[model samples]
Target: MSEEKPQRKIIHVDMDAFYASVEQLDNPELRGKPVAVGGSETRGVVSAASYEARKFGVRSALSGVLAKKYCPDLIFVRPRFDRYKEVSNKIRQIFHEFTDLVEPLSLDEAYLDVTQNKKGNPSASLIAKEIRERILAETGLTASAGISVNKFVAKIASDVNKPNGQKTIGPDEVESFLEQLPIKKFYGVGKVTTERMYQLGIFTGADLKAQSLEFLEKHFGKSGTYYYYAVRGIHNSEVKPERTTKSVAAEHTFNENLSSEIYMQEQLQAIAEQLAKRLKRYELAGKTVTLKIKYSDFTLQTRSKTLPYFISDKGLILETATELLYQERMKDSVRLLGISLSNLNNEERKTVVVQLRFEF
Candidate 1:
């Protein structure tokens, strides 16, 4: 007889238009309007757009100028990342009540492994429901959830019922569910990959499954092997808790391009200060400092240096960033300047080790 496979319960939770929803909740007047959270319409890009704004073809990452052209009445509000982080902490607290196996993807999304939970609850769906209700009650915001046996399925399922909803995929239904899914709907399959898949006559999960593993590997490289097993509902990747923060960064886009090195240094100082505060808040320090510059002609350049010791002091970060800035020859007038710190020191890093066992 075959050994029984271990079953895992995973849940993916995503806040609905998190930033725009927060804006609406705080100010009653902004509710039900086409609102975008970003910089001024004169420059910069839309960071997030409300569902109403999306109706007019406005979306996150769309340039602010184009967003205005799409919806002239679109209200652009500056992003409040600190406020969003505060709310994210509250949501995380709720997840902890059910499971300690929580992995935050961003300020608005997370993955929780509840196969074994604090409440000793085996029903992942019920836990997802309770979580959503608690989030709505505590934050006055709606979150959608997806519950499944693994991270990949759960992450995809969460989006099926977006904007204050939830979906579940049972173990028995996994293969069938994937077979009917469109190629573009697969997680990690970007526009370029989709175009390639379409050209190869692979438009759905079923079509992808029809190809031999050897054929997939020959054509798509390592990812082809992933698709072969994924289509058949085989995924062994564990749900990692507390995803690492590889870097911390802060950036600013100016209305007018800056040509003078002195003025650029001033902007870099402010950005370094912001980065230092973020590092301090997270109790993290780094040995590397990187400077990024975007010129008016849309050209981008970056320079980085690694220090001997990890330092999170504002003055030290500014000094290092300025040095890097000056080292690079000016390509063109700058429109944006930023700084980032890497090589973080995370004290709570988790590692798992496996050993072979033989049954007598």
Candidate 2:
């Protein structure tokens, strides 16, 4: 008889409207208001929009102009990335308490491999609920969690109930769920892929599964095999830790789009302070500082410069970031502004020396 291996347990957690939520949480006046962490205007793109703004079709990465069309009364505000990172760290600390198998996907999302956890918890669903609750309790923010037997199902499950909700995809119900899953809901099926799939009559998991493996492979290459198995709830991906993180950033959206250079520089200053805090917290230093800007029309632009050596000093990073911001030509009404540090250098691992003794 063959020995049975333990099942893989993965959990996916994502912040609900991360940037916008942070903005709303910090200022009581901002709550329930149509707030966006991007420039307010038709020139810049929206970086992050609150739930209230989203009702008007406002969304992240949309041009400020389009956002206004969706919600004309939308109030734009500059991004405060520094504050967001502080909140993110608090959330990360909470994840570690349950299990060390954390893999941060971004500042806003992560995958946790809790198959064998520190707490020795039997059920992943319980752990997920607890984590979501803790996130709310600790950061005054809402998060959604997806618990499943593997990474693929876990990620999909997390999105099933969004904005302060939790969902579980048990092993038994995997097939039934996939059968009704719209192609658009599949992880990798983006706008371009969906349009193409629609034209080819691929609407749901059943539609996707009807195609032969050979045909899918012919079109999507190696990813085709993923689609073939993914629709059937087979996922083998692992939770990769963020030990390789090389940078940290902070950014903000504005209430009103600004074409004025002076105002944009002021926004950069705030973002720089926030970026510096994250760098110091992680004990990291970087040689490069980058400034990101978005126009009200949704056009994006960035400028970056590398220093002679990596440093974690706030003043130095801000100086370099400020320089980069100035170097760029202000062409349109800026809706969003951001700052980030990269090309990191910090402490190296210590190697211990051991002595051996010979006895007679």
Candidate 3:
């Protein structure tokens, strides 16, 4: 007598504050103030913030001079990214109208699975409240969700009631909701693994389910078997609708600080023409071509080259990022410049897992 192996719904969807709420939804006098999309309160950073600039703690990689000293009426807005990818393709066409098993993860989060959908809905919390009310009635924007039973507790319950709101755990409340969560709200625990799980005292998920999977693989060696089956709710990762584009980049960050290499090959020819217009808008091509360097005391360097073919031109990515920016030299006074492309021709699309059974 052995059965039980079907429990997967998943959800995640997240947006709210996506590029400062799409610059306050296409500027209506930046609605209720405090916006901030990119940066320039005298330099760069802050790639998004709003919820009235996160109430004075203005986040998202902060520092447009400390987010104008933490919201001196912060209002910087300049990152349309093609109007946030045309409202992230109309909220991914309203999440494929219920589920093609989406998985996006950026342009503003995603990870649906719906455990058998196409609107014969069986409540993944009312299909994440009708996909956050049809992404606020077709992109006036405002989304947040997190139903569960996988994709790591629906990506930490889509940040428990953030901006808009949503949160479902069910399946008998996913093991006491991951045992009272908070190992820095786990979902790939960061900030250096939440200070190495608070120096091993593991601060919750019931202190990492009282250790030992051989003491968390002797202290997280393979993420200690993913915090031992994610606090025993046991995740079986899925919801992957073809996501593969390993690398294609472009960078600049230089409002001053280039101690000439003919101004770093004229800023690597405008970052290899914005990485060849993002590898010709994803018709992608690559065979390695990295060359990132940021100095002015913020020390960092990289130089790479690997090609026998694949290259998305812009004069061959500025002649291999100007031969790795003169194959390296001035280690000081640089301030950032980048270009990247990496062994890609974009293939790798074969993930089809469909296990059905649902109950919320």
Best by lDDT: 1
For model 1, residues 1-360, the per-residue Cα lDDT tens digits are 122323778899999999999999999999999999995678779999999999999998899899999999999998887899899999999999987888999999999988877886668899899999999999999999998877888989999999899999988878899999999999988899999999999999999999999989998999998888888777767767857899999999897899999999999888988898899777899999999899998888889999999999999999999899889579889999999999877655784523122110
Query: lDDT of model 1 at residue 236?
Result: 66
- On residues 1-360, what C-alpha lDDT tens digit does candidate 3 reach at each position? 112334888888899888887777778899999988887898878888888878888888877999898778788977867778778989998899988989896888989898898999888888888888988988778888888878888889889999799888877878788889888988888889889889878888988988878888887788888778777778776888988879989888787789888888987898899789878865799889988888999888899999999989889889888988897578688988898899998888897787888667
**Candidate numbers, best lDDT first, in rank order:** 1, 3, 2
lDDT of 2 by residue, 1-360 (tens): 112212577889999999989988888999999888976685767889999998988889888878888898898989877787788889999999987778887778889877766787778888898899989988889999988766887888899999899888777777788889999998988898888879878999999989887888887789788888888777766666544676788888888898887887777777777787787766788888888888899898888888888777767877777777678578988899988888888433332222122110
Q: What stretches of model 1 exceed 4 Å from their correct place?
A: 1-6, 250-274, 277-283, 291-303, 313-315, 325-338, 351-360
Question: TM-score per candidate, in order?
Answer: 0.84, 0.71, 0.35
- Winner on lDDT between 1 and 3 is 1
RMSD (CA, Å), each prediction: 4.7, 8.9, 21.0
Worst 10-residue lDDT window for candidate 2 reads: 351-360
**Which is the winner by lDDT between candidate 2 and candidate 3?**
3
Q: Is candidate 1 or candidate 2 better by lDDT?
A: 1
lDDT computed for candidate 3: 0.84
Pick out the ten consecutive residues of candidate 3 with the lowest summed lDDT: 1-10
Best by TM-score: 1
Q: In model 2, how large is the Cα lDDT of residue 85?
A: 77
